[model samples]
Target: MANFIKIIFFLIIVGGIGIYFLSQSPKIFQGSPQEKVSAPSQTFVSPAPTSYTSPSLSPAPQAISDYLIPSGFSRGQLSPYFEKINISASYAYSHFNPSEIKLSSNLSDNEKVNITGWQIKTNNGEIIIPQAINVYEPSGLFPQQDIVLSGNNYVNIYLSVNPINKNFRLNNCIGYLQNDYVFSPSLPQNCPTPSRSEISYLSGQCQSYILSLWGCKVPDKDSDSFYVSIGGSSEEEVECRAFLDTIDQNGCFRKHRFDSDFLSNEWRLWIREHILDSQHDRVLLFDKQGLLVDEYTY
Candidate 1:
């Protein structure tokens, strides 16, 4: 009986040991193969950039009305013989063409006359002459000399002496004398002629051979018109006319329409031939008929 009990106990101990070994084996050998971690997948994309710009500006509008004087009369300096005259435009635009004034008096040679008052009438019947005492007289004449009317006015009857020659002869007088009592024509506003010295200087320095090649002369009939030429070729003639029109008193010409060569040549020629160095610059004095009465190139 005792042997039987001991055998049973031994078998029980052996079974317990086998069960512990089985549990421990599973814990030590059951782990799967180790796996390596991979970095997150990435995509490269370029970013869009913004652009900047500045605002644009607009130009202002120009004015429309233009002031223009009548065709004749030395716009300003209308003598003070007229009364109650009103100019068509403001005095600013009073560029009168001297030829337009008409004289109504027949005078003996060297006769003295007295001018009382005068008036200025516009083409539209507008009178601009102001009411004033005698404002003009021959340099040597008395204070009460003949009435000198300027602008577009019909001169009243009056007797006056021949300021220049002092010849006592009756003449149809329409204009006033400068320093002397001769009825010479009036000159344009600015004289365009060049003195001899000016011509010499310009000829020596200017680059345009054509400019140095040309000649200049005063106009016979009209004080405002002048002649310029390089031996009278058709091209040269055309160029001369174009140059005169450019420097005309009216200032009406398109600079861009002319060629660069033509402008340069004309400018060089004008500088060489027309600019005066002396005290007396060439000037145009007009008569009542807008004719070149006298020219002084001092």
Candidate 2:
């Protein structure tokens, strides 16, 4: 029994020594003084983009006044002024012979519009037009800027679209001008030609070789196919309006529909010259005042 008691005392003393030693030793699994616990790595994420907008896609500017201005007055300090106007986009149809577009407009309702100007917009966003403009009257090309009039009615105006662009696209628009003063035909009449850097696409003769660089063809002045887009009753028309409607929606020109006699060297040459550049998808039009008028995207 005495030996057993001695053994127990010995075990108790040894245990205390072991415990003290353990307390002084550095920890490994639970982080020692020199060791550190590594945290999980963090990931990075970018913020989403804000609203998308294009400066080039902004809408064109409009004239300030709704009424006709007197002749001799400048448009907001410019030589030729465009008055309040509206485009008859629906009734716009193609015209041939001289290669022009016959567009009807409601201009100077309270006053007759004698003088006018225009520009052409191509599918590639670049205007294929010259700076020179020729105002026309019922008699033909009017050289003098003279007018005798009563206003408030629809007038038919002509714009040359004979040569389609490389992309087979074109838009011609007449600008409506206005200013402040007693406007009258008696007021010294003259529409001086504006000087331009590039050749105006609108100045060329349809079949003449001098204007051949423009790649023009005789247009189908008789066809009313594009009318469906503006509310023409296709059901009552000669050609099926539904089929015509398809072509209009797609904006494609069918050779058969344009004119039955389209297979000519002139037509072929025009097509070859005015080949559309895929890189240029937008065409823009500006008035004499250097303001945006119209744009076409193909």
Candidate 3:
């Protein structure tokens, strides 16, 4: 009985030690099958950090071109004189000076092309090329002619109000209008100088005064010094005044209207306001049939 009791005590001590070790181990747990699921591994998955983005505040780019070039129309080919016409790369596209676009014709072209009804398109707007008088007559009524582009000719299109009510061809006499109206690109003041034959009938003093006068200029009758410089009797002064009157545009037109070289190679066309962009622009030229003639970008 003593030996069996001692063996029983030894067995109880070994079982107590095993129970203490099991209690110290957290991973080794005594529980139901459902609880033994290892607590789903308790991995900290800090919900994928929410990402954010900001919106852009800038404006989108502006689209300049709207029309497609016709298939047959290519540079220097496939149309009547379209190839000979060109838009100058240089521009007066500013707010300070009058906005201007220049179109030129090749010097080698054999035939003249009428550009009336042609269209010039820009980023801001479009304009129809209008008819202008081929030769300007300072008459009460003026007729309109097609805007013709002869060989080595050019046109200056101004985006400003027309000084004259209608567009007209530049002439030697047109420079006289510079006194009354302002031309953006000033008119060519190349009027024919008066010869001695014009004043040979007058007295020496009167003849010298008349010959000394500039072409395309109206003597300043308003100035007191004008009469002093003329140094003539009232009757003679009347004759001088009459002669001076003939030096104006109307007078010049009357004198040189029949001359073959009277007309200039340039045309000045005025358009409505706000037709061009001041910062940058793409200019396009289309013929009467809306075929592309030329394009210029700046």
Candidate 4:
């Protein structure tokens, strides 16, 4: 009986140790349907870059031809000659002076004389005559033995020698006189001869006159008067036209006329009067006391 009990005790102890080991072992479960764990889905996307382009440019308009004058003529050198004469005399004549000579027959009353020589004496009492002529005129009567006259003499003379210069003073004088009346009809009664500056401005008119006395370019709008661009710029056409429209209520652009003739001394006086008035308006002021004041700023 003792041997059987001892064998039973050994069997029980072995069963107990097996139970302890089973409790301590890691437990692996049969994961409920083993849900397929897929790697985190990765999505790839591409972005577009922005594009840029330059804008096209337009060319400037060509200038008008009518407003343009020939530039080459502006710089040209024009030399106009008057008259030059060399005189030879065989007769033994005494007491010769430019004043004593009958220039009344040689020149018109309106004509002027500008004499320069070894024999001439100025009205200012200056002796411009050279020493060579002084020796010839020891008696003071025969001032110069050999004399050369050079100037614009208004009259026609039958010269021993036909004038050395064909372009004589007569032609120039006639041209000046004729055009003077045509271009500026409102000229003064004692109209001064046209100078280089006057001729330059009036030459275009003279040329037009030569074409036809009445050949003025008619305005596009059929007006008797028209606007003249003093600034000489076609680009400012819109601005210029607007300015003209503001000043001209009558539609025709006539110049503002003064009370006196344009060339008279009275005209200058009138200008002075208006100038003072304009300046007074610009600088004058009124005080609170209703008195006139000269100060520009309050």
Clashes of each: 36, 18, 0, 0
Tens digit per residue, CA lDDT, model 3, 1-298: 9999999999999999999998876666546465645445576767888855221101111121223343434433323434467775344554336778889887444456778999888777888989987787777567898887767889988777776767878888888888888766677778886778877776676676666667566777778376455655577777776776676778788888888999889888887746566667788888787766777777
Candidate 3's clash total is: 0
- Pairs that collide in candidate 4 are none
lDDT tens per residue, model 2, 1-298? 9999999999999999999878977642356556776889999888988976332222212243424332333334321223222222111222332112222223333433332344434452232332222221222232433222223322222233223211111111010010122211111211121223322332232112222212212222255333323244433333323322322211222212244432111100011122233344433334555544433334
Q: Which scores better on lDDT, 2 or 3?
A: 3
Distance (Å) between predicted and true CA of 46, model 1? Answer: 99
Question: Could you estimate the TM-score for every candidate?
Answer: 0.18, 0.21, 0.67, 0.14
Q: In lDDT terms, how accurate is model 1?
A: 0.29
> How close to the true structure is residue 18 of candidate 1, measured as C-alpha lDDT?
92
lDDT values, one for every candidate? 0.29, 0.30, 0.71, 0.25
Task: Please tell me which predicted candidate would have the highest lDDT against the true structure.
Answer: 3
Per-residue alpha-carbon lDDT of model 1 for 1-298, expressed as tens digits? 9999999999999999998899898565656365345689999988888754211100101121113222243334222211112211111111221112223322223322222223223222312212222322223342433333332323321111122423111111111132122232221122233345533433232214324322222222233322423325565455544444433212211222232321110000000011222233333233233322222233
**Model 4 TM-score on a 0 to 1 scale:** 0.14
Residue 221 accuracy (lDDT) in model 4: 30
lDDT of 3: 0.71
